[model samples]
Target: MRLPTLRRTRTVEPGIVTGTARLDRRTKRLVGRLRPGDIAIIDHVDLDRVAADSLVAVGVAAVLNAKPSVSGRYPNLGPEVLIEAGIPLLDDLGETVFQAVREGANVRIDGNTVLLDGEPVAHGVRQDAETVAKAMADAREGLSVQLEAFAANTMEYLKQERDLLFDGVGVPEVETRIGGRHCLIVVRGYDYKADLDVLRPYIREYKPVLIGVDGGADALVEAGYTPDMIIGDMDSVTDDVLRCGAEVIVHAYPDGRAPGLARVQQLGLSAVTFPAAATSEDLAMLLADEKGASLLVAVGTHATLVEFLDKGRGGMASTFLTRLKVGGKLVDAKGVSRLYRQNISGSSLLLLVLSAVAAMASAVAVSTVGKAYLGVASEWWDNLVFQIGQLLGRLF
Candidate 1:
């Protein structure tokens, strides 16, 4: 096979948003110092709440997609937003591109475009809409790929400390060791809140070792559940949650440039740092297996190809590999909520039926025994009939 290219062909900077896009209050306030035509480099972009019309109204020239929606992952909707706004979008290029070339680089993509890095790379490319669409498709698949890279990096770090960490901690298998025991992972995605509501009773009942991957910790606390442990790079989590009484584990690459650790340390909270390549979600499962959580119930997790790529990730080799390592204890709660029906419990129904039967029997017996009691029973019976009639009237 031919060697892969290190430099991307497209003229793009990973996180740069150029033009007159009206930033959200958060964004506007953040780079408030920035003037019109200045580039905005954002970390993650949500498809929902993307103000396409507003960005177009501001008259931005182009947007740099830092968080590329993978081939089939969650809808980034940035491209559609920019395209509809008549702004060109250069995707998947990040700080590396900017670091590679000093001074600002502007793209001119009307008919075709050219670039001047240290030297020229390519020029006069075809403006094939189909090709651009395909790139967007590939971009959507990037989420899963990025997740795998994270897991792989994490595994390498874990391996270095494996002898020090794994063998000493966990016990022999109790309910099957694959997903691990001492920890439980909760992911907040899709309709996870609704699913967790259904699982709240079960969680209160079983109280499996709790591990929240970043934002899941907040979700746990919001639902009246306590997290025993928390894991993730630490982005997207609130400072309040970082101080929450759980033992925090900060996931980082072996390179040691952990952005979240600073906040954790700044709060003076003691945390165990695990350097691994997998996403916090993967690491949570792996840590559970390492700690020996009996069952791993995942709520609102993204398992499909589309989900993986939406994060601008590559193929999900490591995630698949991690699942193979601990798929047994892993249960997707999406189906659990959908498959089970909710209603009054059997005991409640039985008690209600017995009460009705006893009422009827008491009325009949009292009526049969004596006239005075019969008069009382007749009144009770009439009241019951009237109540039932009113209930039926309302229901019908």
Candidate 2:
């Protein structure tokens, strides 16, 4: 019986992710407070690339979404970004997860289930690279339907904002004198940092009136430049940027409800309100055009259809119409950076210097007066070399 003793084999389970839960319905606001190793619980449906990028930037342990990350809604780019960054994404955990899980509570994710104190609180489908790819492929099939909705929304926006769009009726006057000067409008969109870096020469030469919209103001400040004007709903821009001495313009609702005005007032900063139905990005362009800017250069603005959809709002329709209205004077910063690269390369510059030196030396050798000057220079060099040789010989 003692000789019959045997050992049983045990299979190893997959790794369980544990972290402090941080919940917010708004992904943007939640990201501000997220610390590394914290689990972000959000309700963002068809999460956009910007939000995903923010989450990845914050280095969250995992993402637990209450809604579908990809709802077959025109190939939203957020979920893929999270997965590509190697962040764990648990999708569609339902709204009850908000009730079951308290903020700041330590939680564990085992497989597809969320655990609080070793008890399952919520469950969802764990997403991987394969799942995200499949979802994106399915989402592409629904693009036509989304396009139709976008077109209808565009028409509605046109009807509502005809006066402001055509006549610039509600645009506020700013203290910054933009008349006849090139205006640079910045939005905190895709590849903004790279675009701003390449435009340094243009910024120095043209000295465009810099305008930052919402979080774009922070972008400008981060890039080592001061904004001449800051415009937005004031939700995202920091208090320090508001006090950066830029002329502040608040984008208000059509009904005159300026929610961001109170925050600006609390900071003791004076800002003019432009009450319109358009987004802050559109409002900035409208103000620049109305104020008689000679050229409008846009940076980090949504230019493509997918980008517009990624905004996840009906207001993006306003952007499409805004582009059409300001197309004549508008230029994308990416396009400008591409077309305007440094004409002089270092190798070519060195070659040019050598060519000039050769030409001067040849002229000096051929001319009588130049020959006399060269002889004097050669004698001086010979005397210097003789002095150096005598000094070296004495030292040795």
Candidate 3:
């Protein structure tokens, strides 16, 4: 297939772009410090799996995508981010894309032409997108692997700057009837936001205490719910929510001091610093169970070796270990939007009934006393009216 060439609209190192870097470990490890003309080799991506929003924020030129950015239910949002950033991105050649392109394929991009080992790959890839979609579908698993590799590499890149995810507070198992458990939803990726929107109704109905891990707070507010707690390292989360009234839990390593907490403290907000090795999601569950919460509902929690490793760390050794710590007390809401069937909008029904009562009382008061309320205070009139309203509302 005729591939598109990368136009150097953005400054990047050319010859140094290694094609085999499905993992962005060394690439992003040197993100802000890269001198202009650095070519970045990215793993795979399809439409459904274009994560790595942070990489796009920094300047990287000429990406050789190792996966389909969009495949299955996932969306390829990463390329779009790259395009906006004026980064030149190219598609790989089938199995050969993987087999021939080992770790360190010398990638050369001039204008729209991309040459890897003297073979032209992509250049000015303007065509009907339907064909592009079919190509992406054809390259599904390969692409997913590529994207996942990049994510895995990204964690390695991040560790050079700082270590995020933790091992978690040590607790064998938690048993608590803490009814109306305050739930904290955590998400590092964008896919979980869609699921969060789906569960908004049920969460409100149960009135679970809502806690967000950094960006999850914005995710909740975007879904029209206010957060009661916010936790995380505070790297990706916004300042407004960081200053929000919700309780802020700064995730610290086993040692007791945390950089995220330090930032929060500088803002003069009260922060409870907790030491753990698991991700903030672990802390969320631990906090709920430790605080005597009834049930802990987790959203976008991580599972599997790939996900845990992609998050960077010694795997989710801490999260896996922590799961043993609070597994029974936690409900993984990864697919909650798909599995949970919601019925009866709780808050809406409450508002509807409140409006109806307000209208009826206004009518009664206006007709009898020219006031907004019936004013049957401490009298037989008020008691009788209230009883009748309650009886009729319950009956019909």
Candidate 4:
């Protein structure tokens, strides 16, 4: 498969573009410190869309990644999004760039080169949409191999998590009333904000039990909805969200080591520790399902092959198992929004227009000016009838 060569439409000249260098090995941590127009330096390999979107939201001028943005593993869309947003992405600068660069230091990117002061430090391939597209196409060729590995992983996961399939074990009891009710599980994945916005009416009407996984809790809070339960390793959730009266569940390793427990303890908050090998998203679904949730609505959860690959999972072993166990009740937020939207047919629209007109007419009828106008219209009709009869009699 031939990958397209990147076009040079928005090429930067071989001149210095200076900005404060914000360096972090962890992309998520660096995002908080990033300021508009600051250059972002990170060590993310196969950069995912979520991180790319966050960086775009922060309005970074450019990105310098120590690892290959694509890595040929699978077509990661992060680099493409950045390039399309007019933020230049320089990839595969080597791990040494992390050590050489300092936070808040003024760095320069001149064409494909990175420099500190006047000295050259690193050079890399600048990526654009064409390059990313071509890389993704090439990556798809390895899907068969990746799928084999994924199947093996899923088999192993099934062996370990047989209870999830058979007896509903490891499901925790929570104070949230989920049994026989609709549940909305929110994740901080692709276009979650928009999905949540689309769900506003459903949320108001159904008032489903809201479960936020990891940073998803913060997403829910940002959208002005308090989570009924928050579940994850607890690393990405903010401090304020932890105290928002939601029942917190710390997902621990299968060996029962809970790292997030300390943070919860520090806040003088109580949390239930649930140990399992599955992803938090899967765990959340299983918990809701076993707890007797009649319906499960998912937001920002991974549903596509590219999205699964972007998450760096060898195969969607846990996701596959979880969805298999809950697919009967699982529905995407977009699906619900579509159903709600489709209900607004032409007849419904006409009814809405008629109702609006009726409301306006009722308001006008209650006003004195409206009454006077009606009286004038009645007099005009009477005079027109009298004139018509006199003309008829004269003609006869």
TM-score of 3: 0.49
Candidate 2: residue 85 lDDT (0-100): 84
State the C-alpha lDDT per candidate.
Answer: 0.55, 0.89, 0.57, 0.84
Predicted candidate 3 versus true structure: per-residue lDDT over 1-396, tens digit per residue: 012344233334652233323334233333323323445544543422224454554444455554444333333345555656655565543343445444444566554455677786654342134545564455554556655655565455335312322332243232323345656565645457657767767676887888787677766766677778777877656677776677777777766668887778788887777666556776677667666676677776676554553444453445665566567667777776677656679899999999999998778776856442335454668788899999999999
Order the numbered candidates by TM-score, best leading: 2, 4, 1, 3
lDDT of 2 by residue, 234-265 (tens): 98888898899999999899999999999999
Flag regions of model 4 displaced more than 4 Å. Answer: 1-16, 334-396
TM of each candidate vs. truth: 0.53, 0.87, 0.49, 0.83
Top-lDDT candidate index: 2
Residue 309 alpha-carbon offset, candidate 3, angstroms: 2.2
| CA error at residue 315 for candidate 2, angstroms | 1.4
Once superposed on the true structure, which residue ranges of model 3 sit more than 4 Å away at CA?
1-50, 53-182, 340-396
Give the worst 10-residue stretch by lDDT in candidate 4.
1-10
Looking at model 2, residue 256 earns an lDDT score of 92
- Stronger candidate by TM-score (3 vs 4): 4
Tens digit of lDDT per residue, candidate 4, span 1-396?
Answer: 011233222324544467788998888778877777788999999999888988888877789999999888777778888888888889999976777789988888887789898888898888877888898899878877777777788899899889866688777778888889999999988878778888888899999999999899999999999999999998788899999999999999888899999999999999998888888888899899999999999998988766777887653578888888899999977444445543478988999999999998888788999888878998999999999999999999
By TM-score, how accurate is candidate 2? 0.87
Between candidates 2 and 4, which one is better according to lDDT? 2
